[model samples]
Target: MRRLLAICVGIFTATVAWAGMPNVTFPSIDGGTLDMADWSGRPVLVVNTASRCAFTDQYEALQDLYDTYRDAGLVVLAVPSNDFRQELGSAEEVREFCEMTYGIDMPMTDITAVTGAKAHPLYRHVKSETGFVPRWNFNKILFAPDGSVVDTWGSKTTPMSRPLRDAIEAALSGD
Candidate 1:
């Protein structure tokens, strides 16, 4: 009985330790690496983006959100992905287009897979935690300061939508 109890305790401890965000890293579009762990203490808005998708215009709103809330501890991370086959062929092209078109200066990851067997580690971790995956470009996943998923929105949800903004505000204010 004591051995069984000990085993159960160990399992509980291990599960608790793994409850939060996955420790994953991705190559930044500009340079160097992006370690999700680095943003541990700040609320992060992670969006899977595609340069050519119809919803790509949301980049403007994303930048606006970043500009509006970054001062309040919101880290907006734009992760360019080709899972939907709408992203540009190269990171440089993506950078040029985003910069010239929307003047986007937020942090972005290189072309990544947001779904399927080749999904990025961060996406996989998100799926494990929330059982949600990007159905298309512009899907948003909001993470709390502690690295847990606070909320998720589908591709049709605009970055500036009231629900998304409210959630970001709540996460920032610790509501």
Candidate 2:
């Protein structure tokens, strides 16, 4: 009985540890898959974006953040979401708008649902792990190198905001 109990506990712990970002992936907007495994040793900033939202301009800040920290092993993943009904109609439209309007070049996922039962698996995992659902477009979730939630920010928290930048710096430094 003791041995069986120990095995069960070990399995439970492993499951819990693997339940976060590392276990999820999404369809990359460019092509193929965007596996979390590809970003295994880096901190990732996962942002839910909307091309037509008031906060859409945040894309430029996000790009700046990506350009500044990507060399330090940061992955800024843009997930275009329409859960708030503020996104373009299709992934193509989103891609064009982001490129043409903001000159964004970071990795982006196809239009995805960031809330409700139809939310993508990654967002679902994020909600399960941190109880954070994107309350509005441009909400950000930062993950540590070990695939754990580091911090989350609402729409108003721009990418270069003090809190968000501090968290990214800390995560990159493995703090």
**With candidate 1 superimposed using the best TM-score fit, by how many Å does residue 63's alpha carbon deviate from the native?**
0.2
Tell me the RMSD of model 2 versus the true structure.
4.5
What 10-residue stretch in candidate 2 is worst by lDDT?
A: 14-23
TM-scores for all predictions: 0.87, 0.87
Per-residue alpha-carbon lDDT of candidate 2 for residues 16-50, written as tens digits (9 for 90 to 100): 44335334778888877877766876899999999
Best by lDDT: 1
lDDT of 2: 0.87
For candidate 2, the per-residue lDDT at 101 reads 90
Pairs in clash, predicted candidate 2: none
Candidate 1 lDDT by residue in tens digits, 96-156:
9999999999899988888999998778888987899999899999988877889999989
Point out where model 1 deviates above 4 Å: 1-22
